[model samples]
Target: MVMEDMELERLSAAMDGELDDEKLPRLLGGCRHDPALQESWYAFHVIGETLRDPQLPPVRLHSRIAQALKEEPTVLVPKSSVGSVPLDGATQRRWLAMAAAIAVVVLTTALLRPSLPANPVIAQNGQSTPASTENGVSDRDIQTFVALHRQGSPLSEFQTVDYTPQTIAQR
Candidate 1:
């Protein structure tokens, strides 16, 4: 894969007369039989022509672009930081250090924030009885009342576990 990428890079460089004289002949020889490389070469030429003449309408090279993407090698290539304002090594390092410090501070704050004590108002309110229970809607209290009601009346065979008027009426 690396070799393929190198070949493509060399081919691109060769178009601009950047390849060494020793390797130029061999590179040209491979292009003669390589249909994929031939397509790439033609596409590069078309790009150069379009760039040189801004008045010319850009041609759609969808097939060539798709072929290039399909044949692309998964190699990490360092790109030149041209055209934009370039930063010095020291400035870049300082920015990276600042980013790392900010990340550490954020992570530390997140991890420790949960362990802090709850708000006093929330703590007091959470312990208080809910509004429904204040209106005497208690499960245990209802069960006790039902037990007393059951003692005064015997359950009938037609009655279910649920206490209903049908059970008392049958008795």
Candidate 2:
């Protein structure tokens, strides 16, 4: 004769054991037949199992210092096993390479520290010629350039075209 709401109330109270003795089995039996509540129970149990698995990483540690206190101590190495550390050929080569690398870095920094002025120095294309030819361009070269510029100039009043030069001897 118990209603559905009373059954649910019994189930909620059963978790903390506040339910009547006779109602406990009925509340459990009601949940078993309820698909939604049964699914919720399965999900809760799955979460519990996932949390209990040791292979899974711990999500939260309360404090690093407190957690570190629980860890086992590692023993120090015995002196009998330790010997005089000497460099072999490979170790010597590695040390040499490291020294070379450091030297290269220091030299590079010293060489490329930009001691020059920051103003951009631009060189003109035709500004400077070597001392050997410093008296400027040659005369014949200038004459040849003038002749070519005159000969094929479309902008000139007398335009350049296929024209024949007449000789006095042939006339």
Candidate 3:
């Protein structure tokens, strides 16, 4: 068994073109007498050839596959019941009840939904006021708020200051 394994290893190395020249003659001699070694050599050559050219397959592979498929038993599947199955009286009534409940919920939601105002109201100082109206904030009020915000904001400190050669001479 060990000798057979060593022979297989040497045969594999030879197939890879890595075996010593001296051992090549002895390996070839063994392959002549040993049917298993001969099979291994043929298998290795076939594998190498297949790897070199993937488009071709073993000679009898297609025929063997066709024979295997022919020998296989045919499978018959039953038709699916799904929507074709008839529901019992109780089940039919339950389905009808569920459908009616869904319809009622949909209708109730559509009828009870609140209508939205044409113009959205803006809230200021806890009071709801229509924007761009007499009671709402005016342009002057907006400008005053913007000025106050700029004065109070920390970003106001980083404002760009104008510089001149006279200012630099003073510094």
Output the number of the lDDT-best candidate. Answer: 3
Model 1: residue 93 alpha-carbon error in angstroms: 54
Q: What do the candidate models score in CA lDDT, each in turn?
A: 0.46, 0.38, 0.47
Return the lDDT, model 2, position 158: 42
* Clash count list over all predictions: 0, 0, 0
lDDT of 1 by residue, 84-137 (tens): 566689666755754664455445534533433243312132353232121111
List, residue by residue over 1-171, the lDDT tens digit for candidate 3: 698899999988876667776676677768656757866776665455434332232232222222222233223233655546566896667557555644554444334333323466454444533322221112223333444454466876237332221222243
Compute the lDDT of residue 19 as modeled in candidate 2: 64
| Cα distance off (Å), candidate 3, residue 14 | 0.3
lDDT, model 1, position 14:
69
What is the TM-score of each predicted model, taking all chains together? 0.30, 0.22, 0.30
Better model by lDDT: candidate 1 vs candidate 2: 1
